[model samples]
Target chain A: MKADPKGVLTGEHYLDGDFACAEGALAAGCRFFAGYPITPSTEVAERFSERIPEVGGIFIQMEDEMASMNAILGASWGGVKTMTSTSGPGFSLMMENIGLGAMMEVPCVVVNVQRGGPSTGLPTMVGQADMMQARWGSHGDYEIIALSPNSPQECFYVAIEAFNLAEKYRVPVFIMMDECVGHMTEKVIIPPAEEIELYPRRLTNSPPAEYLPYMPEDDLVPSMIIAGQGYKIHTTGLTHDERGYPVMTAEAQEKLVHRLINKIRLNADHIIHIEEEDTEGAEVVVVSYGISSRVALAAIDEARAAGIRVGRLRLITVWPFPEKRIRELAPKVKAFVVPEINYGQMVLEVERCAAGQAKTILVSHGGGDVHNPQDILEAIKESIK
Target chain B: MEQSRTEIKITGFGGQGVILAAYIIGKAAALFDKKEATLTQSFGPEARGGACSAQMVISNSKVLYPYVKRPQILVCLSQEAYNKFEPELISGGLLIIEKDLVKPKPAENGIQLLAIPATRIAEELGRRMVLNIVTVGFFTAVADVVGEEAVRGAIKDSVPKGTEDLNLKAFERGFQYGKNLREHGE
Candidate 1:
């Protein structure tokens, strides 16, 4: 489906990543935004507040991240495309409800413009420390989709993809943008409304009386009905049956929990997006995501100049990771070098996927600025050795 | 001079619009000149008048790393900025500074120093607010990193809607100064 013309900003714009992200959400038909302002990530919320009014949408400044999370879920349940954005600390607070959103199968987009942190470590700096947190912070055996963008342009594009994925799977989607990408300014060309594609909200064709809220179709995703649509619906954080009623039994739990995980794991091929370059005949491959991917390229270039056959695998969709590709490449490449802003997160995934078939080397940073290209270059050289 | 990549740093006090100067240059290159540019800035704690800077990388290919570790062109609008960032300039780098604000020691070997009275020129333009635009104009003429028409178009697109004429005038004043400097071989 084409984007709503009212929400589209059709032009070439010089925009920062945060503002671009907001534009992408609008263009994706996100009509409801509830967020609490936090540094680095606040620009996303601020832009939404400013632009939402013009598009005849709604932007709510919630009291906290927890409320913001719940509000987006509520808005989604009301049949509106919804989103919220926050940083590391706020993201931590939103985890509980993010799990709620996951359990209830709420379709919403959450943007994390990551910063240096265990807790508010550096509000105004870059970090990719939230990768693992985005996957597991919400405490449960549930799955979510997350996309990492390297630049403002990707931030714009990935945001739209996030919303689309959220609708497709009936789950919360994450745009894992770093502080650098959020604050950095670049040119973004927003396509015309007709050119921009959108995934419309999957509404139930089943009549109000016959509609079952949690009934799954062949795709394992259930169609949604708006709260005021005269359908009797019930959704909670607890395990529920097709009728959306809590059934306190292991059988119900098994059915519900299994579907929650498999919906994403089974569709991994369709959900995963990676950019691979020169992997053929490569002795070493550098695995990276978000801003780290761009920084790693400099090192990759330097390694190439030194006559090393190094390839690059950039993870655009960090979650539902391209595990199959890594497994395929592990035996071909001598080693895989993973670099990220965190001490070590996604490297663990690379290590798991490589599975001792090849040497897995991690170049970890505590996160303030980006890795020096020379440092990554050294790691690539060492990996080949 | 036209390498695969060029890194630029624009530094000054917060109110001097150092970030805007970088933004305009980036837009000029990326949007108008069709080169790839990425710009990142330092968001210090202080609100106004504190140390402010923006880093940009322009490349024929995509800019892999966004931050400018070693700036090829360092434009300093304040003395403090010059002192703090001067050490990071490459040996053969071009140093552009505000003549009245920064009192440099001597020009080092392989370093080309060009000074402009951007703030004074802006004051003559009837508003000190356009000082950054003037600096942008001078930088365009002196550096040749982006075309004159591209920078002018970027300035028109960036500044406030009604103030385009004022900003363009500021840009022209500094651009003329820079052109004269090049012609005189100063």
Candidate 2:
């Protein structure tokens, strides 16, 4: 269908926030979305069941989050781009599988439309508390790609980018669109079909017999052959040999796990993206991400207009921490301002990246009410003076 | 000579589809008309019976924030929303309320006010589910924020594949209702 450019229209038609999310997944070249319907998040599952088939893709509502996570991994092994969207409790269920995807080097996207939680905190309400959980949730010693989009439009593009990064590095990816952005509707530009860049599976001519799922000398990521492709391929949760077969010995396990984790961690410099504004000779700096980033922008911009030497650093990729860039700026900048839903998750990273070069301040907000640009701007003023 | 940003608030009960109405208005202003707009909805514990409001800011420049503290336009689909959000209405702002659902009447004499029977009009059109869309039709025709072409495009995707005709008819009726408001002095 040709996309409407004017970005508005009305009719007897109505859609809840969930259906738009399903559409976003489909448009992002997600060939598979495996999830079990759990309140709020179920809308994504229900819509995917109807829409994915229409797009010649697969949508399977797995029995549970664990099954859903593994199913996406299985689909990725079959050489298709796969994904799953879930919330907090279900996110807990999928953690072990996330660790496996990281170890196995499978490329896919996992969306956590976060709701409140110690466990099912507020099923229908919104929360940004999972900002830290996304980075350290799954038990692992590896780096992950996590994106938090402030709106649904960004959700569409970020979801596409999640798949792209996953494929580019051959690693699992995460999209952390909180309950607010995930369900919120905006005039999302469904870019004309020609503008979209969809990355297909990278296969090699080494053929079924010669293919080694874990052997790559040049590119950081290795190519794989599917189960029915006449390839003698092996996959594992256990540390394995180059051909992906599990070895009982510790030496092979150590080497395989080391390579898997190192692939993402060592290449962190390539994957990091942070947006900067008026930081030329910034004295006070405000750092934020996701929807909070919007307020940060306002805060910084308003401060600038008010003659405050305030700058903003908005993280595009929260994981793998953009430490190198922050470290580079440490000497030049005076102070660091970190605002997130959680009290001090990224603040720790910022303080470490600053390496005692600058004083760090934290502006935190939890569930009931989100902060305004004035609050952040006030912090910026206080930090500098 | 400076431009003042426009913030609009639309509110009603939870089941009234007020969020969708605010979203369509915001999308129209921001994406279709090439203006800057931000949309925000009321959330938290009292989300059921308490007044639900979605605020939108439309400007010719980048929207500084999404929070709408003072609104130039306020649409009330229920009485509670009218009372709760009425204080936020700007001087000489426009207020549109659903005649049947809200009572006690607003006391703001300076603001322009119009009352439409949205639910009753939608039920007459055969489906009450489109009460929000009906409200949107009135909004577009009254404010002229979104182009007719873009409104058609929004309607196509938002509505289901089968019921396009009824929606169009309802849109036309609601749009004309806004036009007829001043002519038939009630």
Candidate 3:
């Protein structure tokens, strides 16, 4: 479906990543935003608040992150695309409700403009430490879709994709942006509304008497219905059957949870998105995402100038891990060099996927700033040895 | 590509439009000039009255490293900014300063310096807040990184709706000052 022309601001503009993300959400038909503003990520909420009135939407400054997350989920079920943005501390606060959103199959977008972590470590600094947290933060065995965009331009496109995936999969999609990309300013070109594709909410056509809220289609994703519609639906966080009623039994949990996980896992091939370069015959592959990918490219260039066969694998989709591609390249490359702002989070997934077929080296920074290209170059050089 | 890449740093006390100056330059290069530009800034937690610095990299190709390592062009509107960031300027780099606010010691390693009374020019124009636009004009003329028309378009796009006329006049004054300094020996 084409994006709504009313919400699309089609033009070239110099904007930061946060503003671009807000524009992207609007372009993707996000009409409701509820978030507690935090540094770095605050601009996303600010932009939404400023533009939502003219764009015909609701911008709520929720009291806290938990309420913010809950409000978005409620809004999504109320039949509007919704989103919330935050940094580390607020991200932690939203986890429980995020889990509930997942369990209830509510489609919404959650953007984590990550900062240095542990406990409000650096509110305004860059950090990718939440990579693991983004994947497992909400708990339980449910699957998720997370994207990492490297630039302000990509942030615009990624926000739209986040919404598309959320509506398509009936799950909360995460846009795992870091403080650097969130704050860095660059040129972002938003295309015309007719050119932008959007995924409309998967509304069921079943009659009110026959509609089963949790019943999966052939794709394993159940259709959603808006609250207060004629259709009777029971959405809950408890383990439930196809009728959306809680069934307290081991089999019921198995059935519901398995479908929730497999909806993403079974369709991982279609959902996983990555950008690869020069990996065909390279001995070392530099695997990175978000802001680190841009820095890693500089290192890759330096390594290449020094006559190293280094390739680039930038993860556009961080979650679902792109394990197959890693496994394929693991046997061919001598090692995989992972440079991220966090201390060795995503590298663990790379190592596990490599499965001793190739080495995995981590170029880690504890945050506050991006890694020096020379440090990543050193890691790339070390990978060959 | 390395020779074509121009790294610029603009620094001043907050409320001086330091970031906005960088934004205009970046917007000029990226939006109007059709080049790639990335701007990143650093400042204290205060909303105003703190030291603030913005760095930008304008390149023909993609800017892989977003932050400036050593700026080739440094513009300082305050003495503290000059003192803090002066040592990091590359040798033979272009250093632009506000003559009334900053006091430079001596040029070393063939570094070139250009001074403009941006605040004085803005004051003469009856709007002291447009000092950053004056500096941007001076930098555009002297540094010659981005085209004049491109910066003009960016300024018109960026500044408040009613202030474009005044800001453009302030820009012209600084640009004329810079042109004079470059044509004759300064």
Candidate 4:
């Protein structure tokens, strides 16, 4: 399906990443937004509030992050695509409700324009520290899709991809953007509506009397029915069955939880997106995502110029961790050098995937800013040694 | 001007449109001139009368590292901003200042300096808020970093709809002053 023309702002624009994310949401048919404005991410909510009215959508300023997360879930179930944006402290507050969204199998988008963390660390600085939290913070054994964008252009394009993934899989999708990408201004090109493709909501065709809200159709994902559509439904955070009733038994828990995990696990190949360069028979591979990927490219160029056989692996989609590719490269490369704004969040995943086959060198920082290219270049040099 | 990349810093007190000046230059280079530019700014809980600064990197290719370590061009609109950021200017770099506002300290060898009374020129245009626009105009003519017509198009695209004529006049005033300085071999 093509994007709605009313929501598309087709032109060449000079904008920051936060504003670009908001435009992406609008273009992707997200008609409902609920958020409490926070630094480094407030521009997204501001843009949404200013633009939503023009497109005949709802923009709610909730009192706090908890309410904001729950409001989006409710809006999504009420038959509209929904989203919310926040930074570190606010992101922490939304975790419990994010778990609720996952448990309920609701389709929604959460954007974290990350700042320095571990409790109000730096309100207005950059950080990629929340990479692990995006995967594991919400709770027990559930899977969600996450994307990392390096620039304003990717922030615009990847945000639409985030929404489409959510709609396709019926799970919450996260956009983990750091303050550097969120605040930095650059050129972004938004394509025309017909050029953009969107995934329409999967509505069940069964009559009201025959519909089962939690019943899956071979794909492990269930078709959804909006409230007030003459279909009776009951949804909750507690473990529920196909009829949407709370079932406290262990058997019910196993059945419900397994479906939640398998939906994403079965479709992992479709959800993961990676960009690779020069990985063929290389001695070292630099693994990075978001802004770090671009920074790593400079080091890669310098390393290649100095006669080092180094390759680049940039993760456009961070979660559902490209385990297969990493494992394949582990035995082939001498080492995987990971450079991130955070101390060592995603490096652990890379190390696990390598699994003693190759050395994993983590070029870690505490993240008020991005990595120095020379520091990464030094790590790449050490990897070859 | 034909280099791979150039780093620039623009600084002033809050409410002086320091960030806006950087945005205009970045837009002119990235959008209008079809170059690549990334603009980043400082954001924190500073005091009411705090120094505000914005950094930009303009390149023929993609910008990898966003922050400006040693700026090749520094534009200071206030004494405090000049004092705070002057030492970070690279040797042989260009330093631009508001002649009425900043009494700059003398610098090392091979430095090029351009001073303009941008606030006075903006006042002559009957609006003091366009001082940053005037500074941008001066930068376009003298810096040789971004194209002149590109910056003009950027100013028109960015400023408020009703105030385009006033802002363009302010730009013309600063550009003429810069052209005069170059013509007289100053």
Residue-level lDDT tens digits of model 1 in B28-114: 999999998899998848526866789999988887888988999999999889998999999999999999999997989699999
lDDT of 3 by residue, B136-185 (tens): 99998999889999999999999999999999998899898999999995
> Scoring model 1 with DockQ, what do you get?
0.57
Clashing pairs in 2: A8-B150, A9-B151, A9-B154, A9-B155, A10-B151, A10-B155, A13-B159
Which 10 residues in a row give candidate 1 chain A its minimum summed lDDT? A225-234
lDDT string for model 1 (A195-250, tens) is 88888888999999899888898989999988886988889988899999999999
lDDT of 3 at A46: 96
lDDT of 3 by residue, A177-289 (tens): 99999999999999999999989999999999999999999999999898898987788999999999999999999999999999999999999999999999999999999
Query: What is the C-alpha local distance difference test score of candidate 3?
Result: 0.93
Give lDDT: candidate 1, residue A383.
88
Candidate 2, residues A116-203: lDDT per residue as tens digits?
A: 6668787766667776777778875766788777765666667667877898888888887666565554555656554666666667
Task: Pick the winner on lDDT between candidates 2 and 4.
Answer: 4
Listed in order, the DockQ scores are: 0.57, 0.31, 0.70, 0.65
Clashing pairs in 3: none
Q: Model 3: how large is the Cα RMSD against the reference?
A: 1.2
Reference-based lDDT, residue A83, model 1: 94
